[model samples]
Target: MRKNLRVAAYAICVRDDRILLARSPAADGTPEWVLPGGGMEHGEDPYDTVVREVEEETGYHVEVTALLGVNSLRRTFPGRLLRRPTDHHGVRLLYEARIVGGDLRNEVNGSTDLAAWQDLDAVTGLRRIPLVDAGLRLWRERPAGGRVQPP
Candidate 1:
């Protein structure tokens, strides 16, 4: 049994009735919206990871105010970079972050194609990555300082 703990940080950056999202670029160069942030590096704090990732992905400095919740997920990728039935359990720490500095700009050297604010309702109809809904739901009905069980 090969199990790897993948810790990641995500920020729910909201301002003026909209949320900041990174439009992920597909292999064919298509776009799909997702929450801003990414994986945490070894020995890095989750709080710092969220701030760093949000800035790197969305070009905005964020101040992580509260710890939302954790999510555990399993993924299997075949014919991918990661093979051999690896159990990737993620401890996703969501945060309520306020944009403190940095201009909103699409990172020229990054994974996403677009970095901008989008209507929260607009997300309902659009095709989004899994983490988007999870992050939003967590942001809306935040836990009473506890963990969110996996469904």
Candidate 2:
């Protein structure tokens, strides 16, 4: 079996009855909403990954409160991808976080199309990254222990 290990972090930031989300540009330049965060750097702690990503994407310092859960998925790179498909896999670490400080400004180097607070109820109508569903599922189970580990 071909196995690939990747590490990424994501933050679920809730503020004043709304969630802070970043709208990222899709492969074709269309906008798709997603939580603000990104891949872990060499030797960087996962916790710090989320913090650093949040700042880079939204210019906001965030305080991670707890681990939401881990999401592992098997996926193949698009055939047109220049990289090898054997190297494709997703290992994401999602966390629940709160904004600490800094003004909400989009980073010039960011891949985000837009950044703004969206009403919780209206999120269903927006296009979201796949991980958002997993993150929200874990968030809903906040006090119920956590995702049942595979037996």
Candidate 3:
């Protein structure tokens, strides 16, 4: 099996009682909601990655405020492009961000299809990526170590 490791960053942008989210384009199957960010480019700072990704996905210029936390997950799944079962590990840096400028809009010809601000309380009803919940947890209870505490 092929092994793959991905390093990425995500933004947790909340205003009023809503949270910004991006609807990922259907790839593995059903489209899922995700935080507005993606894998880091070669030698790119995670902070820069977050800023660029947010604009690409949500059409919003954002300023990353604080480092929230990190979350990692590993899984085995069939690859979309390679068409083979593969082992994948994803390391994600979550950051608190604020929209500084630009108008809200959906991404075009990107990994994500749409962007929207969802009611925080209504998020539970959406088919979302696990990172959304993990990021929210980190945002709400900021641990000193910048890591999620196991229950």
TM-score of each: 0.87, 0.87, 0.91
Between 1 and 3, whose TM-score is larger?
A: 3
lDDT, candidate 1, 1-151, per-residue tens: 4678888989988788898998887656677887888888989999999999999888888888888887768875444555566667877888889999999988777777788888888888876787788887788888786455544
Which regions of candidate 1 are displaced past 4 Å? 26-29, 79-83, 145-151
For residues 54-129, write the lDDT of model 3, one tens digit per residue.
9999999999999998999999987678587889999999999999999999999999889999999999899997
Clashing pairs in 2: none
Please report the candidate that would top TM-score against the real structure.
3
lDDT per residue (tens digit) for residues 1-151 in model 2: 3457788999989777788899898878788999899889999999999999999888899999999888787766544446544655788888999988998987676678567889888888998877776777787676355553432
TM for candidate 3 is: 0.91
lDDT of 2 at 132: 75
Candidate models: Cα lDDT each: 0.82, 0.82, 0.93
The segments of candidate 2 whose C-alpha lies over 4 angstroms from its true place after superposition are 1-4, 81-83, 143-145, 148-151
Task: Evaluate model 2: give its lDDT.
Answer: 0.82
